[model samples]
Target chain A: MRNRLVVQLVDFDLAAEYRRLCELDGAVGAVVTFCGLVRDCEQQAPIDSLTLQHYPGMTEASLGDIVASADRRWPLHGITIIHRVGELLPRDQIVFVGVASGHRAAAFQAADYLMDYLKTRAMFWKNVAHGGERQWVDCKDSDRQAAHRWSQDPKRQ
Target chain B: MIKLLFFGRLGDATYAAPEVFEASVGLTAAGVRDALSSLYPALGRALFEPQVLVSVDRVIVDWQQPLLDGCELAFLPPVTGG
Candidate 1:
């Protein structure tokens, strides 16, 4: 199966990416995908848009490591992770993660694992625009907690 | 010489990335951080705040890690990506 990892300024097509993964291996029976979007409000404040920034070489390397980690833990056919940068309006797609495998469990866990790692470790930063003001978003404790679980999972390790 | 990079809000405050620094032999990442903090105290305060992450040559590392000559050092603030 084909594995795709990308960071670009353009939007990602989730259906096409998932279809590509599912079609890559004929034996694949399950495909799990996650798409993160920019919401209109955060913390009860209205937001106009979000600006995402990331390191060029380092961002790619970090994402590769994350995918490799997921690959080692699961028997998977294919995986795709596409993240967008630059300014994005509300309701816009921010990231896409897809996994294909013979069973639903493997695909589901791998997709979750990939998204967890991508949240804190992917070297991306976001700035939110609200009420004519803009500010960089802070890391959430919940996100860190989510990523931390994999570290403690013996099977995942 | 070591190449230093600042990303996200750190870049905004520092106003530059890929800045160069003269590093002596046996310097550690922590040492270089202190030197940078003092050199640009404002950036130092903002960048080294709790939860900041550092990398050596693109791989995440502890501050105590030794710095190699010609290596690239990057400072990253808390990430908020999905």
Candidate 2:
């Protein structure tokens, strides 16, 4: 089905990933992609770098479940999710989510849904280096709220 | 034996390598947590926190979940990745 779910220590090519989604099916008229980059500052402090840690087997499995949930919600032609691990400097790409569908609304919503779930459901943990100190990033209540909204959608139920 | 793993801040707090623990009969996830807490007090406190989660063989489970021999047990802190 041309779905790509990956967690790696290397960066990914957004163009290449988008092209793969386009080629998944001739009916795919829309492809939406979301790329996440490390911010340069955290809490007004200039960040030096970020390190991501993840559980090996569980991380991949969790990604699969997220994709599956998205597929169940929308009519998606293809999906691509790539998350980078290990040390990353500011502005470095940390994650990519792409969705292709027969129409724009499905593609857009699915991509949004994928990203929301990935932020909260995926197993990767982010640790930031800033102001000569290192601290693990805490899960934001907003991220949890974003994920919760999807479940609260009456259409899904 | 159950293999134990810690991630994120929990990993840093414990500075632990993946360790094997002998699982006695009818060992529950809570039992393992209590046992490990005595060994690593910092980890104990973290695990008792509201956000920490326990996974058995890579699947999130409740504290009452039973452990089987050769299973992997992991304590996950609140995840923050995009």
Candidate 3:
């Protein structure tokens, strides 16, 4: 039942987050974490910076819902999701998803599900600055497909 | 009053500041879109584009969704965050 959901303009500490998840329960045997980083290049062009925009109230609510859904689907000891907003340079951490469970299978799958849903369901947008031009990033078809796969067989894993 | 929010590209295309208007009875989400569209044609095209989502009070709803006083209506482009 130890769950942490945060949306902030500042960065998060992965080590501290991992330790928190580790101490969630004595039964926790596996911890899975995923961190998304800003890339240095988009397509073939070098990028200057990336700006993340999000609906303040809606973004937090959406993250809460995604975490709740993951909790229902798995027997997790803890879950942590932190997403950063505002301007960020290349290689900056953009998102972090961590799940702790009694077993590796549950922990791994829950973390994966959390990320897939976050990419599509969360109300956050990314805009990239490249060559002095800025543009909003578009949702990828592959990401849609990845999220769709989870719905296809909910009972699996 | 109904508060309208535009995010991402929509915010850039239109006003970044939240727009507020007096909420009249029988007003629907589509009505607001039409009202804004007539005033901003370029934004109107973007609003009509595929994948643009409309949310009322933080929840996604159809265009026919009715508005309530003091509700927050947000127009969101397809989200790309990880």
Positional deviation of A148 in candidate 3, in angstroms? 0.3
Across A49-78, the per-residue lDDT of candidate 1 in tens digits comes to 999999888899889899988989999998
Give the Å shift of residue A69 in candidate 3. Answer: 1.0
Higher-ranked by DockQ: 2 or 3: 2
TM-score of chain A of each: 0.95, 0.96, 0.97
Between prediction 1 and prediction 2, the one with superior DockQ is 2
Comparing candidate 1 with candidate 2, which one achieves the higher lDDT? 2
Clashing pairs in 3: none
User: Which parts of model 2 have CA positions greater than 4 angstroms off?
Assistant: A155-157, B13-18
Which ten-residue region of model 1 chain A has the weakest summed lDDT? A148-157
DockQ of 2: 0.89
The CAPRI class of candidate 1 is medium
Give me the displacement of residue A118 in model 3, in angstroms: 0.7
lDDT of 3 by residue, A1-157 (tens): 4999999999989999999999988999999999999999987789999999999888999999999999888999999999999999999999999999999999999999999999998999999999888988899999999888888985754
* Candidate 2, A18-39: lDDT as tens digits: 8898989999999999999999
Global lDDT scores for all candidate models: 0.88, 0.90, 0.90
Docking class of 3: high
Clashing pairs in 2: none
